[model samples]
Target: MEAGGWAAAYARLCREGGAEPQQSVVQQLRARAGAGLDLAARSLSRDTCGALGRLLRDAAPFPALALADCMLGDDGAKLLLHGLCSNTTVKSLDLKGNNLQAVGAEALGKLLQQNKSIQSLVLEWNSLGVWEEGFSLFCQGLSANRSLQRLDLRNNQINHEGAGELAAALKGNSSLQELDLRWNNVGLLGGRALLNCLHSNRTLRRLELAGNNVPSDILKAVEQAMDHNQDRQSILAENQSRTHVLSKEVLSLKEEKAKQFLNLMDTIDRQREEITRSSRQSSARVGQLQEALAERHSIVNSLKAKLQMAEAALALSEQKVHDLGELLSTAKQEQATMAERQAKDLQQQKQEAADREMKLLRDLSAANEKNLLLRNQVDELERRGKAQQDQLFQLKQDLTTTVADLRLRAVQAEERLDMEKRRFKQGLDDVESLRQKEVDHMTQHMEASERSMQERMQRLEAVRIGLEETGAESGQSCSACGTRPGGGGVNQSPEPGQAGGATAAGAPGGEATADDAVTRGGPGPLLAAEAGSRGGAGQGQPAEPAGGESSAAGGGAAAGPEQQGAGEGGRGEQGTRGAAGAGWAPAGRADSSGRAAGENCSPGAADESAVQQPPRGPAGQGGGDGRSPGEATDQGSRDLPDEGGGGTARQLPSERHSGLRAGVPAGHPQPQEVTRPRHLSLRRCYRTG
Candidate 1:
């Protein structure tokens, strides 16, 4: 039937039963006392049954469905059972006294097998077991149904055969807790089968077999088995509850232990990190101590070598003194013998003189003529001495004039050397200044490049973020609008190439600027300029002898005018010899100046220069007018500072004005002191570079 016709019929049925026909089926079901729909003892046609089945299948709110005494036979029962097969809401079904036969019983059995919500089924006053095949099928459905806990089959006219089938079904049925088969024709055979099934059936707690014509003994045994099953079920339920509580406690304890273990692991990790840090620090300290100890050992070894040299020198000096003492003793003995011989000879000559005095009177006239000739020879020698004295006076005046002229030339040379030194120092200062500017520019360029790179990275990051946001927005729009496959309303985000091009456009200028700065002469040009200045300074200065001559001139400043003039004349001669040597020693001078420039360019040069002041003082003093060039160089080498007692020789400048002042004696003037500030300025320039 159509749905409207069934709904109209249902309304008419509700009105006839004195229920409010204005309410819908669901409302009436919910408003009823048991939330059930009852059409019991009513004339329900096939159309009504279908309507009810449809309601049940569509998940109606009915918890109880009653079609008792409604005269719904096999077909009506099948219709109702069809809907209940898929129904989940109905927990109780009443289909008693409907004259249902084998067909209806089979349909009901199918309903029980499919419907999981129905816990109670009432089939009382039905002829369900009249057909063995139908009753057997119903038993089969009961064996599979797990939701039905109570089954009512009272007065269904079931005989021993049907009872045996039910007993067989009960052997596997674990859900049915109660079974009512009262007013049946069950005999000894059916009772015995039920009794045997109790051994395997654990969920069936109640079974009624009264008025079934069963034997008393079999009935009593079945009763006893049912009681035993109930008690066993109660005990199992209690044990399961206790086990659940214990499992909960174990889970909580496991969680707490895991948390504690994690905390301990964290603490150990922190302690291990601290230990590693301390060990690293200790290793570094040990390295420093080892270096210091090595330096001390080197100093001790050098001191031992010096001591050995001193001991050897002492032995040699002692041997020389012994040899001289022996020679003196031999000479003293020879002198005594010579004095004794002379005394003997004088006595013999006196005896001979006494004989000569007797003959002297006779020879007196001849001796007077010889004395007159000796007086004439003395007068000629006195005249020659006067002429030689006049010639010596004239030569002295000419020597004095030559000394004055040489002194004047020496002063002019000194002034020219001073001018060249000033020019060289100025050039070094300019080069240092230019180098400083280049370094500053490079630093600025690097900073600018770094900033530009950071900005570009930030821009790329922003573009990426924008792309992500655009993608997210596009996805949301697509899902919300359900756009067609070929739709073109949304615009796509810009590509990476376009964004990269924009960022790349501003980058080349900074790179080009950096490249230009490097090409314009970075540190390389600065070093070259410094070398050129050093070379020029070396070329402008006079040779090694000039340094000695200048010191002599300084010393001469303290003497009387005539003595100073004589000293200046000696200085001029020495200066001429230095000029001749300078012509041949240009290469050596260039090498020395280059070495000095290298030292000044080094990072530790300032510290070394400060530490080696004492050694330089002696070197400057050793380069005086009294020393030869070879001797001066040797003295400078001997005075060179030894680092950590290791004799690493270095050639430092010997004419440092500060060293000169320290080395000069108390009476001597420091003519080179005026150039000290210029040297200090040049050092400052090197340090800045």
Candidate 2:
């Protein structure tokens, strides 16, 4: 049954199938146990076992239930014993092999303390004492079973220490008679502890220690009881048997002695026959005298007793008369005193009665006056209340109408506010979306520029290598270019507008990409070392040349007048480094820009304000710098008066600019009158300062 079905199952569970209510198995068990089944053996695994425990728990006289082989385990032990704690009649229990562990033992120990009728318990083959806790609990459980006479803890895990503890329990358990601790690992030490229990246990009459390897001294002690009590037992038994045998022997000897005496008596009687006749006459005379004397003594005793009784009656009569006279004198004296007090009491009572009557009349008169005043005040209040009621009625009607109007106005205002809020929310979402798109665009453009510059640098380095190799292979001029400028192509003299206008499309007269670098002859070989950041060039092994090309070129290119051998500032190369159109400028500049941008976004400064942008349009978005200063001034002067909730009455920009219109000519229509109904119309987008 489920936990929630306790009520329904209570009736149905106890009824067996196909049986009348009175004759059901549960009913018959209840009849035997009186009102409720006592011995219950419950097994969830099997019906018979479950019924046993349940029947025991429900029975009235409580059950000496045997729950062996039930396999109910610890939980079932708990359920069965939890019910038994309230039961009073159960005196014995056997929980032989239900797998009750330490926890189960502790639980049963607690129940045992509260149960009173349980007197014997068997936990054989259970895992008691397998753990310290279980052993301690089993010992403690003994304290509650003060009436327990037998405790069989056979085949348990009671070792030396546990056996010692059990022995100690026996010391306090005065009612326990038999204990079965067989088949445990109770070694020599444990057996000795049991022997110690036997030394003090007086109630134990029977013991089974056959399988136990007890010490010879302990066994001898059991045999030695005869030395202490043998005499008393033997004496009591022998005395009865000896008395019967002696009585028979004495009867036979007395019969033989009697026969001999009878013969002797016959001779003596013949001799004494004459004397017997003489003694009879004397005996008769003496009997008459003795009888007379006895009668005289009896009469004397009767006279003495009668005289003594008469004297006692005379003394009692005198005592009675004297007491009566004394009582009569006391009564008369008391009567005189009582009469004098009674007169004084009568006078006092009359005076009090008159005083009470006067006070009552005074109280009554005051009560009547108060009642009349109260009635007059009540009538005055009634008139005033009626007038106040009329005024209150008019006030109530006015309040009801005012409340209805206020409720309608509040609802209308709330609806308008909600519409304005939704518009502001949409504007905020649009603005946020635009900002995100702008950030993504900037990021993509930066990445594209960096990738292009890196590719261009790699190409420039490859071309430079090819030209140097061709120069070396040809042994006269670079095959890639086939020749140099040969001192210059059109060395125009000092043309003021024409400076070193180097184009990026040729490197020392060859191909180039977007980035171009130019350098005039300089000292120290003008080493404008550029690092590669992509592909095999990222290996960045400086482009070396065979036959000491760098050193050979350095001798004069390094010393040839360090800058542009020019006089004017028209060095048209934008970022002129030492390399002549080598395409390294864009790569270096792009790399630096990327580095700076990455640093800006590093976990350093807290502010991202450097990246934020202001809107430039009527929608209040985009990067706006086109609005003239004067236009802003005009708009500020034309704005409607600020309202409390940050929202002003929606106004067209032209309509608000009336002062500007007034200053203009009349023929040109005023913007205030000519509504543009566009960006000119007021857009209510509010921002916090």
Candidate 3:
């Protein structure tokens, strides 16, 4: 068909219409060399398609071929698929609009690798791209083409790597039914590698990725791989007619007797499940040996009841070992009769221990003469109790040196009673500054006797208004001026210890009234007994022998008492206690001082004669002498009633002369001084100023 008679009628019209070549008959069979070819719509050029591909490689197997729209380039598509590779008769081949570049798609992939009688192949609008090493050698010659069924690769700008090497040559081409790949760029990864080669392609029923940019779920995964390869070719045509049309040697002897009767019924159901699991493990070891033979028959009836309670405790330990061998033969005959009554009580305890050791050697020689007369009567009662404890330690060191000289005379009688209370508060502040300068000189003589009694009642109210204007000539000077203020004011009531006793009893004029001057006995009679009666009337005294010589000179100026008859009976009771503590008075002078203490014998009989006086001795322990006859009867009953209460006798004679010079002034101290040293007696400070 190399241009000899219209190219042999265009290769017998493309092998009698198994049709392909059109375009002006592949440009007149690419300018003439074509044994059996049809150049469809031909406008051939490229050297007339390389001389019609060397006349189909010196043409012999020329069954069908076509070079469509042949403006063929790339050396006329590598000289027409290299003359259809070792053409075993071109089975309908066609190159449409052949601009087949990559060496004409690698010479149509080595003409489908040694042309196994090319089954219908057509490369349309061929650029053959798959990054063109000739479309991966045309997918390895369409996977070693077994007799390639129809493939078209239309619009071959074949992309997704030439549609993944033509989807791996349609998964190793099992005679590809038909793969068109229309409009080129087989996108979505070459339409998912052609839907995974038609998912185990039974025989690619006709997968033609239409219009290239392939997606539609990869064309519904190639139509579910063509309905699963048409349900595996309708189950291989119902297992090839289910062997009933059998006779492949009687269907291989009925499939080997149905596989040896299903392998002997699966070895008789695994030996009947291993004989029902060895009869449930031999009925669980025969119920664990019947519960260990009922726990060894309850441990042989509890060891035959503990072997009959150990044979009744070995017959009560053989009758307590024959009653302890008859109490060890009656304790060896009571230890041989207590060793013959302990050898006759050891010969009567050795003759009563040698007559009780000679009556304990005559009672230990009368208890060693009564223990040496009780150690000489305990050394004569500890030497008469150590000489009566050295006479009570020299009578407690003479009563602690008379209580430290009566605490130094009670701290010098509390510093002479705080210096006689600061000299009786400076003699009552100098008798309240001489009674406030005699009450401001009696308030300026009662404001000059109230301005001279308001100018003598305004001159007796102007002489009774001039005696009622000299009526009856002044009525005798208004009755002698109202009896001259009631007899020149003898009224004197207000001395109840006077602090102006109610303004001297409201004295406009006066008249005695303070209980009649406290029954008339104080104020003027005892200034320290009138200085001891003017010192016994200046020695010429006879006032009862100067009051018994001023009570024996105040008991010889008593540093302590000598008791001159209790200081002459406390100076005869000191005038009713100086008129009741100088509330004062002048009425009968306390009944003449109670008759001078009933004739000087009553101050409790001079305090019972100074308490029967007779105690001075140690040479009268004189610290300034004299007074211990009970301190001369307590200093004549304490300075005769506090010096007869002159202004309460200036605080009871400095508290009874500091309790007769501290013989007792320790007022509240002793709980019990050695069994009562009479309140730990002190004495001696009578220094009054």
Candidate 4:
């Protein structure tokens, strides 16, 4: 009868060609759908395949659906899956090698999420790797499905990354019992992740990943995990049965305990009645004890009052003793403080006195040192004065000697003039006598000789005057030109008229000035020579004054003649030399002071002054005393203040002239103006001076 019923249901399902099948035919075809429907290797048209989907859906309790190797494509798979919405009867779905691709796989995955009765799924060789969405959606659908117990995904191009997604989905899937991922592209990593997931997965009983790149050990682990899962499931089933038995025993024990509780409640009521009667008797005895206690309390209060009075007396005694001790301590502290304060004051006063004594000692020492320095300075001043006096004496002696020489020369010059005058007078007499004789002879011999005779007389007069003038110039040049020790005298006779007739009185005024300068510069040496001469004369008989004059003139004239031959009058030349030499003495004096005091003052001052001064000539030469006049002037300048910095003193020409004249002795001839004869200006000679 069952075979007949199944055969009729199959015939009915086949005959129902339209999408909307009869409800009775769907119920009759349910048994055949559960037996398994294989549509592999078929070339069903699109309309026929869609009609098959309606037939399966109409069968309310369809159990399995297989369309393997049918090449149904994604459209056919989607149409067939529409019959499995909210399906609870289908246990297995086999779509292996159907060329479903991603669209078909995604549709199937969504169907799995909606269906709760699917226990196994076979989707091998479906090209699930063609689109990642298919594999991912399928994995997600598996996570929502709790009733799917078996999965077959062999040779479906599932790489390690997709395999990993499947492994992650299995972590939450408790109902999936078997998984097939054999002959796919899953590597060792995906195999390991699946192997690890199986360790905690209690429900998955079988996992197949053979003929893949995964290691064999991972496969072994998967097999062991499946075995372990099966054992856990059996154990869990036993525990559930045990738990049910224990729950029944606990309910029976609860009822037995409730009966004992009711008996205990009845016993408590009887005990409470006996306790209440005993409490009433105890309450009466407590009242009597409280009365006696009150009497004892009053007796204790009386005794406490007496004890308080005694304690007060003892406290008053202690307070009085404490006050006495405090007063004693305060008096001792005051005495010690007074003594310490007095000691500190005494020590302070002693220290102050010592400080004052030390200060006085230092002051005395400083005053003594100052006094010693002043004494030394006074001694030095005295020594300087003595030295200056010696220099002055030497200069005065030089002047006196030169004066003697000049006076002697002047006498000789007078005598020679007188001799020349007598000679000229005799020559005139002779010429006049001869002319008279010639006139008398010519007049006797011929007439017309008177004019010639007058002309010859006038010529003779002119010749006499010229001879007198020449003689006067020679005598003046000889007298005024003084001799230097190693060089010539200074003469100004070549053109005396150029000096505005300074030589009008038969003497070269400029040359006289030159002679004075030489005398002042070399006074010591020349005077020493004059002193020797005078000494020699005084020691012996008197020397001839005439011979002295000739010797003096002859000695000085040797160098003068050459210099005089160069120019007519050297008044201008002599003026410059005199001006330069005038300062030379003083400047040389400053140079000596610079050599002495150069250590005390800045050498810059001395060096700058040296640059400004003119170069020294014969005037800088030392005298017979082996001391240049510069030394004397230098010593004198030291006594005078500089009045200007940088070793140069500022003084007007007139002031300097007065100062210089004041220094000169009364015996020496005083120049009206200390200046060059050419311009008569009081010219400044030396800044260092």
Candidate number with greatest lDDT: 1
Off by over 4 Å in 3: 1-82, 89-116, 119-125, 128-147, 150-155, 158-175, 178-203, 206-211, 214-218, 237-689
Output the better candidate (1/2) by TM-score.
1
Give per-model TM-scores.
Answer: 0.37, 0.28, 0.20, 0.33
Q: TM-score for candidate 4, please give it.
A: 0.33
Tens-place lDDT digits, model 2, residues 494-564: 23332211111101211122122221121111122211111112111221211111211111100111111
Residue 114 alpha-carbon offset, candidate 2, angstroms: 2.3
Query: Candidate 3, residues 1-689: lDDT per residue as tens digits?
Result: 23454556555545454544444654544464435556566566544454445545644445776667767777767765676576675678877776777776777778788877878888777677744687888788888788887888777677777677777777777777767777777788878877876765677667777787777876886877787886787787788887556767687889999999999999999999999999999999999999999999999999999999999999999999999999999999999999999999999999999999999999999999999999999999999999999999999999999989988988888887888788777776665554444334333433342333233223322322322232232234324434221121011222233221000001112221111100011111111111122112212111121122121212111111111111222232333221111111111111112111112212211111011122222211111122222223223123222222221111111111111100111222211111101111111112121
**Top-TM-score structure, candidate number:** 1
Worst 10 residues of 4 by lDDT: 558-567
- Against the reference, the lDDT scores of all candidates come to 0.53, 0.45, 0.48, 0.51
- RMSD (Cα, Å) for all candidates, in order, is 64.0, 44.2, 34.9, 33.3
What ranking of all candidate models by lDDT puts the best one first?
1, 4, 3, 2
Model 4, span 153-265: residue lDDT tens? 88888888888888888987888877888888888988988887776678887778887788878778788888888898889989999999999988888988898898889
Which 10-residue window of candidate 3 scores lowest in summed lDDT? 513-522
- What is the overall TM-score of model 3 with all chains considered together? 0.20
Question: What stretches of model 1 exceed 4 Å from their correct place?
Answer: 1-27, 30-34, 38-43, 250-265, 277-689
Question: Which segments of model 4 are wrong by more than 4 Å?
Answer: 1-35, 38-41, 244-689
> Residue 419's C-alpha lDDT in candidate 3?
82
